[model samples]
Target: MAEKDQVAARARAVTERFQFGPWSMMTVKSHILKSEGPTRERFESQLELPQVPEMIFADNVLRVIHDDGYGIEFNALDALKCVDAHHDPLKVAVSQAWREARSSCEHINDVVKPFDWTFTTDYKGTLLEKEDKKITVSETTERIDIEKLKVREKILFYEDMLLFEDELADNGTSLLNVRMRVMPSGFFILLRFFMRVDNVMIRVNDTRLHYQAGKNYMLREFSTKDDQVKEIKASQHLFTDPNEIANHLTLRKEVFEKLQFPETPPEEGS
Candidate 1:
């Protein structure tokens, strides 16, 4: 009972802005696919999402929904290990799924959306130090290495999640979207999906994740029920295409048809 209570307590403790900031990061490399004939070249501008989630665990998976009605299933383990090699027991304990509200999400552009903001955080770890009789070091030494310590990234895509207020968005939104290409030197590929937000708080197992696009949107307890930072539901969530998140998958029209072709029969058959 005590262990279970501790687990639950730790789970509840995971809600703060940057709960698992100290854990190591596993980099994720995503392959992409595109269907539209307009092959896009040139490196698109990258926007530094203020914070990206730092805690994605082993064997855990997340289904991402973008505004374009596209959905992608993210294997937290593969994304971390394959991309960066995520390996930390504490990360699993502290990190929960995206658990927050789904409101106050701003839009960037009609073609571009932003989401998958882990969060920006700086955490510290400690190591024991030993000293000789002459070197009696009773105090703890502290240091900060911003360069290699924690890595942050922003995940962007186009989504069906509508932006009612045009004033809140502009053309700048397209600059930060995720880029998927076959060749590093050839052409860059752009895929459409949902989840355009400024920041997101995700708890691995929880569903009510909070995400907001564009920095500094309205955030109030009343914005969502139960005082969650964001509210998440099917109606408000934008989907992402899983194939798009994976760089290996080609975004061929036939591929799209295979993944999401409706049951509608051909006119001739009807």
Candidate 2:
């Protein structure tokens, strides 16, 4: 009973929910991280990666559900699964030095596996569908209206959650985070994985979702920006903030898709 109560208490402390138009959103942010025990072991086993991040919020999650029974969720487990565990194409001299330094640390060498130490992921999020009501996602030329998002509106709800992060053995930083905002007009979400390998390279993978009020569809855009450290002319201070550094990198890839939802019936009360 005590353990069950404690679990319930922790769940209550970390979760928040809100309803915006036809969508319901929830966010979870847990304590720093529990490095040992079942959770950590499970994460490591499923990840199959050489090394875990220095700081991982394994319980963090961002989920959105629509009235039509369609949903999408962002969680550390799913995001990490998208990371390349077999290769490290972005490796460079600095990466090698960092790896060597990490190997020399106590207990580090024993668990080290051959994988991308940077922890870069192109995860967009996981989509969910009700067995009775399925939604279709297809490539679309329609673009998200950036100008519309800038319009003044009443902010309804907002939250930010960090999935995981690593300092790269003091060489640089790698982290994944998600942020969401709700307005009277609609809601928007951004899931970003950013990496900085000191004196080597910087990369940013971003997934943006936008949905308008009363709309039957939502827009999702995935983009990647990367560049060698020497190629970017931005001030060093920008590197501290992922959003700031992202502006300086060059876009390397982009994809756009639309999620079409089925018409949902009105609530009984309405």
Candidate 3:
């Protein structure tokens, strides 16, 4: 009884609105499919949604509908994981999914439309520190090699917003960190990508996009540490063309692939 009450209280807290620097922010977490248009029919007809199991965990799933026709459709058992385990498994999974989605969106222009996909990240930096003090300086330097270093990533969600972070480091120094956030309802995306080497900024690309009713425009501010910042304005038509919808679907596939967890460095003699 106490657990149930606690979870109910938590749900309220998570759904409540909070003040943010003279603005009010809603924290309602939604799991419904969303698109930038006047109606949900437009989104449904244009996009292909993933087929979630109807009977998850050998039982029927549950749907929670909101007044605005958006809601979370999830397994009752899985939903109970939040209260039973005292942690939000669903939130973690949703965040991971959105992270992949944003990655796909980032690469969409390259694969679908004509655009450059080059990333200007400096590799000459220390990212992780050595634990062993007895190790020689040369050994430490070798351990901090950029190509040999692996990229680390994490995804987190706050209500309706999702944040994805991809970082690469040399030794203990930050080489690059790209942080992206996505809002499902508003079709909004924000990205802050930065690269540094030896504490010197190498490149930065800060971008934000909000898809309006008929047309969508993205603003990108690009810069190098020593160079002046440059702005790029890109726009696209929403929901009017079939080709655009197909391109968006391809982007989703690209991002959704990450959730499948592809094997890294396939084994020999397969």
Candidate 4:
């Protein structure tokens, strides 16, 4: 008990000393005695690995927990490596974390441009009117002004969140909007995307990827309305197949890499 306490205390000190931005201090616990049973097997099968990646837990295999409830099990040296990867410790914790994503805003823009395709948003409003001693409810949609569309992007260092937002105006009034937020960590990222496709259609996606653990989950909500008629639906999905995870991870790595860096090489260290 005394030795465990000492190790945990020391680990906490390291995280607190160097942690930055939305990264809060972490709690550390020894995981040396825990059995690698069903969890290990499941992880391997989900990743479809002929053999599990090497598991090297030094004298003290530790479980480190972040403020957002995400955690990982690894050794002290490995833990520090994660922290050094541009403040994204998970990069070292999970090999796949270092890879880039397959698709991104740039890709979408490029593809659509070549095809002469563009996206638009609509605004919907409801009104109640009296007619012949009866009350009638009606909905109206108006197209937003393209010439006045606004776009903005920002990054939140403290919360590890990235945001991209767009808005359009109709007759000097707000008509349509879209917002996207990305919260990323060592093992996965939470992507929250919502868009009002004009007043007639709305789409929302909450996607969470546990690539390291091979747990991929997504929640989708969509609604469409035409004057008096409307349709809405929502669904969720989880995927753990190893092959699928690999493919998704590969594509994700590609897209993300393009966002962070360019193909051109940098000059030698300054």
CA lDDT, candidate 3, residue 148: 19
User: For candidate 2, what is the TM-score?
Assistant: 0.87
Model 1: per-residue lDDT, tens digit, 1-270?
Answer: 257754753454322111111211122322221222122111111223322222222222223332322223333222222111122221232333222212232321221323332221111111112231011112112212223212343322212111111111321121112222112111112222222222332111101112223211111110001111143332222212222222322222211111111122222311
TM-score (all chains, Cα) for each model:
0.16, 0.87, 0.20, 0.20
User: Which tens-of-lDDT digit does each residue in 1-270 have in candidate 4?
Assistant: 357765764664322112323223232333322135543444334432122112212233322233343433323233222112222222232324112211222432343212101111111111112232211212212222223222332322212222222331210111121222222322223333333323222333333222211212111222222110023222111122221222222111111111001112222321
- Global lDDT of each model? 0.22, 0.82, 0.25, 0.25
* Candidate 1 structure lDDT: 0.22
- Best of the candidates, TM-score: 2
- RMSD (Cα, Å) for all candidates, in order, is 26.1, 5.1, 24.4, 24.8
Judge candidate 2 at residue 179 and give its lDDT. Answer: 94
lDDT computed for candidate 3: 0.25
